[model samples]
Target: MIVPICSCYGQTEDGILSKHEKWEFVLEDTGDVLQIAIPLAAGLTTLFKKDYKGSKQFALSYATSLVVTHSLKRIIRKERPEDRNLFDAFPSGHTTSAFSGASFIQRRYGWKYGKWAYLGAAIVGVSRMEGPDGWHDIWDVLAGAAVGIGSTYLFTTPYEKQPVQVGFYSNGNDTYILSLKYEF
Candidate 1:
């Protein structure tokens, strides 16, 4: 149900790609770098912090993004923008992988890092678009971003709601301490 909405924004028929430009290859490599770096960073960070839940969340998010994105690409089996490739084109895997990493940083680490994380994410898609090979259309890139971010956002939850919460409240001269929770 939610999938359609995420994929709706950037799709189009008769899509085209841009001509090659200088220094654009760096953008493509940026996506490739993210695919390797995100998991390594998360693992090291989690180990240093001894945060078992955070590690679990990163692993789940990463795995879910790859599996879902690849599965859809195979199922849709569309073509590349220049038609050099005749399959695996509905969504961009690079874009998806990049977004997955960015979303993880944003969700777990904080938005401070999110700013850079998302810039890399967006760059991956744009780089593909700038290529002479015409690897993907804007719709493909957008759909890839949607899937990668969506899967993580859906699987990873806020840490604010703890299993047990303790708080204190004051009402005029009356002060009180309370704890409450409803887990689903």
Candidate 2:
């Protein structure tokens, strides 16, 4: 049946993968899942925190990254490193998706919170290049990351409540002092 035939396509000799191939598949699959998971998590975090403005910024950044990444993929018409026949490979979409969410979290929240997400995004980029398919080159991965981060940078601002202000107070008399203020 067609289903059986299609299923067989993912297998190697004897419909089984070798140890090396298994690891590669794991990396590829992880990247594939994280690409979607990262963004979805970011959006959900915004909702959970009741950050409506951050939700809008995240949406714009994510949408822009997708649009720009896909548009360049089509316009450049670059071929994949592994697959010669497939031409939509100028930018790695997986990397873009992962970075979009990571950068959004970093910009809208803080690096302390976003560092793990960024690491995940970096793994996505590496997987795109070193995984079983090796679908993209370094340039593609870098460009994807740039597009993702750049879009977020353009639209996202630091969480409004996180600023610390240093104030200098002075009176007509010799009353001068430095005060640090933080709003919780």
Error of 1 at 105 (Å): 1.1
Per-residue CA lDDT of candidate 1, range 1-184, in tens?
Answer: 5432222122223464343343454556665677567546655666687777877887888888889888998898887765565788878888888788778777877888777878878877787787435578999999988987987788676444356656667786867767576565
Give the C-alpha lDDT of model 2. Answer: 0.87
Q: Tens digit of lDDT per residue, candidate 2, span 2-61?
A: 332212125433355423445677788999999998889899989999999999999999
Off by over 4 Å in 2: 1-20, 162-183
C-alpha TM-score for every candidate: 0.69, 0.78
Clashes of each: 1, 0
Task: Locate the minimum summed-lDDT window of 10 residues in model 1.
Answer: 3-12
Off by over 4 Å in 1: 1-21, 159-184
- Residue 120 accuracy (lDDT) in model 1: 73
